[model samples]
Structure formats: structure tokens, C-alpha cells
Target chain A: MYRQDEVKEASFFDTGEGLVFSYGPQHPGTGHFRLIVRVIGDTVLSAEPDPGFVHRGEEKLCEYKTWITNIPHLERPAILDAAGMLYPYCLAVEKLMGVEPPLRARYIRPIVAELNRIGSHFYYFALYGVFLGLTTPFMWAFGDREFVVDLVQFIGGQRITHSYFVPGGVRNDVPKRVPSGLVKQFRAWYRDATGRSPSSDELTDDFQKYVLRVMEFLDARLDHYWDLMLNNALFMDRTVNVGKLTAEEAAKLGVVGVTLRATGIKRDVRIDEPYDAYGEFKFDVPVRTEGDSYARAVVAFEEMRQSIRIITQAVEGLPDGPVKNKQHPVNIRVPAGEAIARAEAAHGESVYYVRSDGTDRPYRVRMLTASFRNLIVIPYLSRGAKLAEIPAIYWSQNVWPVEWDR
Target chain B: MSESKIGYIVNELKQALGESIKEVKIDKKMTKITVEKDALVRAASVLKGLGFDHVKGVTGIDLIALKPPEDSFEVMYHAGSYSVQELANIIVTIATRIPRNNPEVPSLTSIWPSCEYHERETYEMFGIIFSGHPNLKRLLLPEWWSDAPPLRKDYRPPGR
Candidate 1:
């Protein structure tokens, strides 16, 4: 990725050493992160990851904002999976305040979370396709992800940055009726794409019927994803043995999500701790024995199927009741205590350690994102691999730059 | 069942560290173990031996913000397990206090290689030096950063 003349004019290149190539704080693959790769010929000797190009000092800002208001700001780092990002924070705050969200809210939390998970995985596949130079999957993935995002918006009112989860419960209940506009839009799209008018049952305004249809559609789409990206000859050849990580190495480095799951370790926070409705829902934590780029993609793709299963279970099992606990007010001061909560975000396990001083604002909030935990593996795995395979290994770990930077 | 597991780990920690163990807070959610500053590495070794194979997060809290200033910084290492299934759900926070004037602690990267990046981020965020860190230079912060650690209680962001 480095040009000859560009290397010649660079000051760091003047130092007597092997070729030290800085691969993007600007490149499409890196996305606001840089990797300084010191390579001898085509083999990478060591790859030093340079992160924090998008650091927003979110922890510092948390102290200033009220607990409720912080929800909007905290969800920004991993906007694609907004509900997942805020899940732990909301849990921690609720723990400190000593209030539990009602049963209905608990069910809704996971339903929306799995929707975001599906959306986020599609986004990953979209970008992963581009990184592997397959544009067809990119277009197909982003286009497919809209359906999942639409389901989330039906619940949370907004598309991407849904500040839906709060301390005691969600901001609002799932709509009793899906908006007529959304129904017409889906109807029109179905008619245009399939060249036939959709059935009234498929485009019904009933929340349960409509969301289930979307999930069924996405569940069927996973087969095409497997065919297009996961099982493709080029994808398999490029990623199969590239950046192999043993289970021992993965545990030692403390990587999570598909990266750890690919190594055959069944370590998921949702199953381990069983927060919220995760305890009620029965879903498999997908695993693959071969710890390679290909295995990671397979694990991620498999997770989408499991997410759909969880969402279906949640929707079917959702009990009718109050969504929010009215006792906890908007500006409620939390009792002085420290609590740590963990959630299985799309990237991996995101942990939030919150310390409250019996004040409206938090004394300190430490967010350990999944991407930050996996950042260690970038430098570790990139060693001894061909320079061209860097993107495959990097994106395989699912290191979202902004999520880690915050 | 999980509570007893946490109790077992807490007992092991207390027995291993003995006089060095300052406080142990055990709950269903987390088990926080505070140890002496000098005995940090020994505590980490005991934890690793107890099957806490990796560090989850390294957090620094400035206690000066409290009503009567404590004038010290608390660094906590949130450790978890993958090999030990019973201990997998637990987060054992091994914490120690360092003087605000001269905050220094031995790096635990030698014990748990996963602490490498966490320690580096802690160093830059709170200016707590990890003495034996392989690379203790700036991580998240820019190379040209010349201000007090932004996370410190006294170091307010400009225009605040």
C-alpha cells in the first residue's frame, strides 16, 4: 500500500532500517486508525497499531452530563449497535440506583439489541466484502441491513443512533402499530424488487407479525451470504490459513467476539452473566475450531442466525406490562457505589465500570470496549504475515476504531 | 453456585496475599480485591495461578474529587478467566492506591501479556507510570501532548 517515492520523501524512512509502512489513518479499511508496519521485503516483522485518531474523551464528558443524557453521547461510539453499547451502562446505573426494569422492558431490550446485532453484522459483512475487493456483497449487505435497521427504528423511533435504552427501562414501548408510512415503503420496495404486489399479511402494521416477517427474510438471506462471501473460493483462499490464532494465544491476548469464538472458546458475556432477557432466551454461542480469518467470518455469520433466533424467541415470549419503572426519575441521584456490567456487543464483550457518588452525575465511568480489548491482537497477529494479508487479519478481529478510541 | 465460586477465589486471594490483602468486596456481580502497592505483582501471580488468565480492563480513579481530598489515585486491574468456567462470570478487580505526587506501579504485562495495552492506556490517561512496562510511551494521546493527564480530577478541559 506504500508507494516508492512517498517512502523516499518521508522522514521516518530516512532512519536506517527496514521499510516502515504506515497503513492508514485515512485508508478505507483502517477507518480512523493507523498501523505502522515494519517489514523486511514482503514479510511483516512487526506491526505497531496507532489508534486514537478519533478519541472524544467520552469518559471525561460523562462526568459533566446527567445520567440520562449521557445515553445519547455514550451510544455514539458504536452507533451501528446503539442498544448494545448502552446496555451495560444502563445496567450499571440501574444497579447503582437499585431499580429493575419491568419484565416487558427486559424482553424489549434484547429484541432491539438482536435487531441491532443483525444490522451491525451486515455492516461488518458489507465492509468485509469491500476489504476483500468484492463489491457485490457490499451492496447486498448494506441494502439488506436496512430491513434490520427499520425493525430497530420501529421499536426505538430513530434509525441508527437510537437513544432508546435508559436507566430504569427503555425510552418508550414497542409500537402497538407500525407506522403506515413504513408499511407502504416496505410494500412499494417488495413490489419493485420482486415484480409482484406483496401480500397484506407480509406488510401488516401489527408489530409482532411485521418484525417476524423481517427476521424470517434475514434468516433466509444468510444462505446467500454464506454462498457469496463465506464459502467463496477467493475469500477462502485469502483468509483460511492467514493470521491463524490458537485458543491458547487468543486467551493470552484476551481477544473476544468472533476472534475468540473462532478458536473454539465458548466465552460470551450474555451466556456467562445472563443479563436482561438473555437468560430467558435460548441461543447458541457459535464457535469454530479453526482460528483463522475464514473461521472468524463463519462465526460472525453464524451469530447472525443465532441473533435472529433470539429475537424471535424474545418477540414470542414478550409479556405485556409497563415498560418503564416510574419510580426512578430523569434526574435521580444514584446512591454512592461502584458497579461493573458487561454486555455482548456486536464486536465482542463491552464492560462498563461506573462509580457514582450519590449525585446526579457519575463520578467516573470506565468503558472497556470490545475493540480496545482486541486491539492487542493487531500487533500480535500481523507479525510473520504477508503485508497484503494485513487488512484481512485486521478486519477479521472486528476492531471498530471509534468504539476503541472513546 | 457462582457465589461459592467467588467466595473460593476470594479465600484463595486472602490466603495467598495474607497481610498484603487490604480489602475484599465480594458480591454476585464482581469481586474486588485491594492489595498493597508493592505486592501487586505477587497478587497478579496468585490470580493467574487461580485461573484468571487475562486482564479485562485497567482503570484509574482520582480520589481527590471526594469531599475531603484523599490525595491519592487508585488503579484497578479488572481480571477475568477463560480456562476456568466457574470463574468466567466473575470480574476480580485487583486494586492498589498510589500517591498523587508520585504515582508508580509495577507493570503486570510480564504476568499477563494482555495487560500490555491496558497498562499503556492507564499510563497516558491518568499519568500513573507502569515502571517495568515494555513500552510506556503515549498510546491514545498524541505524541505532542504537553498538558496534565486529561482524566485527572484537577486537569479540567479548557473552557470548562
Candidate 2:
């Protein structure tokens, strides 16, 4: 926005090589992460992801905190998908402690997890829309995500950073009554999300029926997402063939989530490991062969539907019993052993490897987040693309900086 | 017990590299194998030939003070597969130990390119040098701060 001479007088003009641009540690799209891009003309030659700007030394800090207090402390990285981020740690701790959560806890955990996944994907879409300079999807996405967040807040006391998961089970059972009217209201809002009612099915009375109703409601909204974002001419023009990756390249870089799925690998932790209630759920892992920015968006949008279907199945199959095992959150000890737990976070496989020394505190903890795994591919994908295509490719892969920095 | 996929992989590993394989242990969740430090690349190559394609994580544990004086710096490469359905779920940890005073192991990026980033992170976190990693630089830590590897047992964070 300033004069062209003011920009030219800076240190960049003296380097005498290709134009070097540093895209933010502060830009709206960068989100506390910096990108050092070396561009020639309008095309980028190399893009180095300069992370650790938001690094809190979380692994270092985990050693200082007690085992019980670290539950909430670990959730600080990926706040939007708080349950998904903390899910692995709980499973690893439970494994080390030699205890298992009850059946009721297992079923209810996935129901809430799918809700959190939907909310996280919605947040990604909102930011994706903002990055593309589209205001409608940004506006529409925020409104739609409130339904899932409200469901989360009703289960836990807070919105994000819900430290609801414990070593034995969830913090508490779902409320005795799911407040039938609220689900119906969300269903009604989702059913007519296109400003016209697409489904004419009447709502049933019980919670299982209510679950099916909400799934049908969100299923209808998927059509509009396809028509607006996925099939839009402008979005297709910008992202279709940009940032293309082969399945071989994806596997080599260890990219996960929609980034890996778009490259034609159908390896979701839900499908592979089948932990928690995922084994009982019937859902498809959406994958695409194109391996482009557009394909990644399509995969993410399709995953929302799969999540909806999974949530519906989980709630319908919700068992009745105690939510937690006998282990209390405060008074617990782990045996001297090592265990690894993997959960499908919003980004990708959130894996935690823990070692305990027959004590209450963990002796060693290693968290391999999806963001850090995918960070290696940034310099590869942005290698030959245009300068402006950087954000389109990066954000479309669902990169979360806090998770990377953690 | 011999029919499970993990058990079969463990057996195959032992059969293929019998002389170099010092120890092999199998649990319900994972398979662990220890090899000589110089034979690390050979074992990794045998693994790659067997279709265990990618490296999931690289972990370095300093047994300098945790165990007896003879204990060394132990590094484990959790290699697994993504393409082969039978081997996809198995996480085979190939372990090797080096002298604590000089920790250097051949980089696995030649066998599995996915370990490039994991090795770089391990190098910075534990100060264990991987000999042939292409761009071995500080990944998570800042450039100028050359303190002790933060994750090592003896190095405490500032103000701790």
C-alpha cells in the first residue's frame, strides 16, 4: 500500500539475487509461523517453513507437570479439536496404567470426537474461505460450526480446550436427556441451510431418531458446499492443478490428513487402527487421486459427511453403563512400561509414545503431531508454484501452526 | 501365535539377518529388534527389501546416567509400511546403540526418505548426529542457541 520507492529503498533491493520475500510470522494467513520464500520473478524457487515461533517447549514442560494436570496442559496445541488432541495422551496413559475405559465411555467418546472433528473442519473451511477472498463461506461456515461447538459445550463445560478426557474414561456421562429440542433446532437449521428445504422427512421422537435427523440435515448441506466451493469455477481455476503431489511423494514426505488422502492413499487412523468406537462405525474414508489443492478441499468436505454418518451411528449404538473405570484422575499410577496411542486428529494421526517408571508421572513422552509430519512437504510443494499460490496450497492442506510449534 | 502378521515379520527379520541381529522381541503391540551399530544400514536395507517402506518416528534415548556405565546412547527407528495391507499396522523398531561420548549413526533417509525430517528433529532434540542426512539443521530450536539437547536427562530448561 505504500509507495513503490519506499519498498525499493529497503535491504531487499541490494541482495542482487532473485527476490527474497518473508511471508509472516505475523500475517493473517501465517498464524504465528513464518515462511521464508525465495522467489524468482513471480514463481517461488524454495519455501522454508520457519516454525517454532509459538514453540512453548511443551514436551519439556510435560516433565514438570503432574500426570493429572498434564491432561489439560497437553490440549494447548490444537485447541479447536481439543478432544482429538488430548485423546491419544489419555489412551497412552490408560495403556500404561493397565486400565480400560468402560463400554459407555467408548461409544460416547467417538460421538463427541466426531462433533469436534466437524467443528474443526468447519473452522478450516472458514479460514479457507477467508484466504480465497470469499466472504459468504466464511460467514456461512462460522454460523454452521456453532451447532457443533454448542454440542461440545453442553457435554463439557467450556467450548475449546475441553479437558473432558481422563485416564480411565471421559469426564462424565452425556446428560441423561440430550435436550431433544436443541437437536431438532439444529436439524431444522441445517436442513434448510440453502434457504430452501431439501428434505421433507419429519423428525422422530427419541435421541436415536434425533441423531439420524441431524445427519440427514448436514448431508443436505454438503450439496451446497459442492456447488459453492468445490465446483465453483473460480476456486477450480485457482487450485485445481496447483500444488500437485504424487502418492509416492506423499508417502515419502509422510504427509497426512486431506493432504495424503488427496494423493490417493486411503490410510486414516480410524480405518487402520480402529480405536475407540471407530470399529463399530460404518463410514468411508474420502480420498481423491488428483493430489491438488482442489482435491484436498473436496476430501475435507466429504470427510465432514463421513464424520456425520459416524456420529449418527455412534449415538444410535450408545450403550448404557458407567462412563469411567475405577481409576480416579487424581490418584493414579502407571506401571513401568512403554505404550503408543494413535488418534485421528483434525489434521492427521496424532500419535503419542509414553514411557512410565511405575510412578504417577510420565518419564518420557514424545508427541508426533500431524503438522510437523506435513511440514516437510511445504518446501517441496511450494517449490515451483507462484508466490500467490503459497497460501492456497498450504491452507488447503489444513496446516495448523500451533500443532506444528508444539 | 506364529500366524499373526506381526509375528511373521519378526520371524522374517530374524531369518534374513541372523548373524547381525543381536536380539529380537515381540509384544502384542510392536516388534523390537536390536542390531550392531555398524550393521544398522544393512538391517534397514533388509527391512526395505521386505516392504517396510516408511519411517514413522526416530527416537534417541540417552542411557548415559540412567543405567550402568557401559550403557550407551540408544537410537530406535520405528519403521512401518503404508502400502502393504499386511504390514501396515506393524511398527518395527530397529534399535542400535553407540558410545555416549560420540553418538553417530548412518541416516535412514537413504532407505526411507520420510526419516529426513524425523532425523533432523532427533538430531536437534538429542544432539545425536545422523551422518548422511542431507540438510541436517536445527529444526525446532533457534539457530544461535547452542545449548544442551533439551530432551536429554541432564539438561534442564533455564530457570528450572
| Best candidate (score: TM-score) | 1
Q: List the per-model TM-score of the A chain.
A: 0.92, 0.91
Where's the lowest-lDDT run of ten residues in candidate 1 chain A?
A1-10
lDDT of 2 at A323: 93
lDDT of 2 by residue, A1-406 (tens): 1123423223243345767778888955635888888877777766788887787878878777777888887988888888888888988887777788899899888887888888889888888878888768887778777767766776777777788888888998776445767755665585466355434344544445555665676777768778878888988888999889898878767778899899998888888878887888899999999999999998999999999989888877789999988765586777877777778988888777777666667777778787778887777777767788887888988888888778
A1-406: candidate 1 lDDT, tens digit per residue: 1223323223333344768878888965645989998877777767798888999999999998989889899998999989878999999988887889999999999998888888889888888888988889889998989898877887888999999999888889998788778777777655544456657866688988778767766776788789998889998988999888999988888888999999999999989989888998888999999999999999999999999999989988889999998855568788888999999999999999999888889999999999999998887777767888888999988778998789
Each candidate's fnat, listed in order, reads 0.64, 0.33
Q: Considering only N, C-alpha and C atoms within 3 Å, which residue pairs clash in candidate 2?
A: none
TM-score of 2: 0.91
Per-residue accuracy of model 1 over B12-59 as CA lDDT, tens digit each: 878888999898888644578899998899999988999999989899
